[model samples]
Target: MRAELLKPGVRPREVWAWAAFDFANSGYTTVVLTAVFNAYFVSVVAGDADWATFVWTCVIALSNAASLLAMPVIGAVADARAEKKKWLFAMTVLCIAATAGLAFAGPGTIVWASLMIVLSNLAYNVGETLNSAFLPEIAPESSLGKVSGWGWAFGYCGGLVTLGASLLVVTQGESFGLTFDQCVAGTMLITAFVFALASTPLFLWLKERSVPRVNAGSSTDSSGTITGAVAESFREVTRTLKALPRYRDFATLALCGFLYQCGVSVVITLSAVYASAVMGFETADTIFMVFLVNITAAIGAFLFGYVQDAIGHKRALAITLLVWLAMIVVACLAETRGMFWAAANLAGLAMGSSQSAGRAMVGVLAPKARLAEFYSFWNMALWVAAIVGPLSYGAVTWMTGNDHRMAIAVTGLFFAAALLALMPLNLDRGRRAAEAAD
Candidate 1:
């Protein structure tokens, strides 16, 4: 195997351990967000209410919105005290618990389910931001694409394992005299267990590398009180926002990420719904399809990392965006089941490469000292996409009298616009600015 380019004091095992968190966390996202729980929430838990899809989007969007205000602050705290692992662990535990909590929801439990989603998704988002901050600490700048791609490709494998396991449980539960609902609930508990078990390596091996500062904006003192840290987090955020113009390419990248990720969020949150509602897929078929798509996504994520490094992050991302637009067009026009499958697989390829490329761009753009804090803003962008994308899909579906294909067609604009926005992002300028900051 080729050796990875890592920073001083960073071990390959430590990097692997860091990547393992993606493996652990993918279970929650694959099972809870994309493949199973979303469909379950709409068709089963909500008892097929005409408004279930809209309600699901509203609850998740509200959850994303609520957490949006707190993300930068959380990032600042982690940076202030080198507390990324601490916060990451806390969030991981809470998300696992909250995912398990989802198992308890059934008919007449809409409020219960929504509450769990808010709690779990918030924790998941925060933990993800913290986890990503470790990338710049561990990998060299030149190899960011491959390293990020490694994590993403590895993560999709994790998702595949968890999804495959969940599929077995879900498909077999009914044979054991369990209702479909009980089968799905059982999968949640299974996902939680796997998530907890797989993540143990991260805590044992990943070390915090940041030196503490009271505030990243101005303070040099490392021993300041937590209250002061919290107060300065806000100030630092303000400073960053005002100074964003200084890093024009990074700002532009964030905007493009926001727009593209909105489309991604729609796919993540609503694809299962679309499969069942528009394409007539059963729960098993949907899970299996997701499983297959994940395989392609893993391949794309792995191969495209080298591509990103070779062609540049901007070019690599633009290629993926083209794939995304193609996926959207194919899906919008698809009538037969086989045609839809081709589109979904295309989406899977774009999904994996685009996300990894975007993340690596952030790592390139962010200064070393402010990894967590800068990545927090990136996380914030994702949450904004989460809110806008799914809600827009839901709105279009509602307004068009449940015409889901039209909703998907409208979703294509996000990718188109993002590609246009990405064309002007100058990576060399961004990298020079980031090195200066460091």
Candidate 2:
């Protein structure tokens, strides 16, 4: 099936190009969202821990909420036309430009910095929504699992390379004679470059697949009117929900995603802080920890990609969640840096697996025509979790005064809940039911 996507076709090159898109944009998620830039945000740019947490929380909450609100309407428009690629390109441009502009922001005007964060997040989420829809068009069913995993694998690797480079510049700031702020700003510029350059292949190579008519709950926007489409989109959501019971596996997986992804985000968001403030680890070692985790994540993506193919998405996700729970327990018990390293690796192992397979599961369960709409729901679930994780972490840290123990314990509960939610999805039974329906 992947062989077909790679061969001569209207979208052969396009398929590969679309896969590269993940590699391109992963820098933002890795460098900015979770690792270096986020570290910089809390430690330097914002400088105040409480203020930093508040800003991070606000930007994340707003951006994700915007992504949730706008996604369905945007997706419905694309799915109703042959212009998914165009919208994707446009959103990519928006993200890149906004991220590039981050180079200009410095130690003043908190509003500007916060705005940049929100805009950057908006672009990232928009790109994700459209990029996901492209997969079903390119990869056939037989190769979808591997192809999806490969794309994610590349993304993790890309994140690793950028993260390593960012750390190098950060560590060598004095010898290079640049201020720490300048070095940190350089990451945003570098982020923009890698994202833009990596994404060029997809823009040049992938042909746009023809869009089909609106699916069950979607509507047309031929009049180019926002008010009308917005009204209809609300109606569509209502209809999608009323009919959602039929897609039980999909709904359950979404709930699982909400819970576990929150756990994942909380850990990633607070890792550096946890190391520095709670465990008394140094900045360099913290960055190294992040680098190590990403490396492990790259491996995990491949290993679990295979696992998903063999055992199916539900079982694979469940196992990963179980592993996540164990990692949190280890975090609670660990007394030194060595133990934390072990926990980080364990987390990396589950991170990509849950994400890659979760997306694949949605692709498999959704109606083909409504793929974009369903992905909107998937993206929404992620944002809902995203909102909860960081805020909850901040609250736990504030209340318990033991960032290490309290944060890990709270996140562990989320993972445990996710595992419980995933239990009913017996792969064989689901396969039989799907087949029977067909």
Candidate with top lDDT is 1
Residue-level lDDT of model 1, residues 76-136, one tens digit each, is 7778767889889999999999999999999879999999999998888888888988998
lDDT (Cα, tens digit) per residue for candidate 2, span 1-438:
345534245455565577788889988887777766565666666775555664666677777777778877777666666677888888899888888877777765466776887888888888887888777666665556677787788788878777788788778876989987787788888888889988999878887675666452334545467765676667667766875677777778788889988988777667776767657765557767778888899899977877887877778888888889889888888888788889889989988888888887776776776677778887888888888887787777666654547766887899988888888765454434444444
| Candidates in order: C-alpha RMSD to true structure | 2.0, 2.7
Model 1, residue 103: distance off in Å is 0.8
| Per-prediction tally of clashes | 0, 1
**Every candidate's lDDT:** 0.88, 0.76
Q: Candidate 1: lDDT over CA atoms?
A: 0.88
List candidate 1 stretches off by more than 4 Å: 1-4, 214-230
Query: How far out, in Å, is residue 349 in model 1?
Result: 0.5
TM-score, every prediction: 0.96, 0.92
Model 1 TM-score relative to the real fold: 0.96
Could you tell me which residue pairs clash in candidate 1?
A: none
Task: Give candidate 2's error at residue 416 in angstroms.
Answer: 0.4
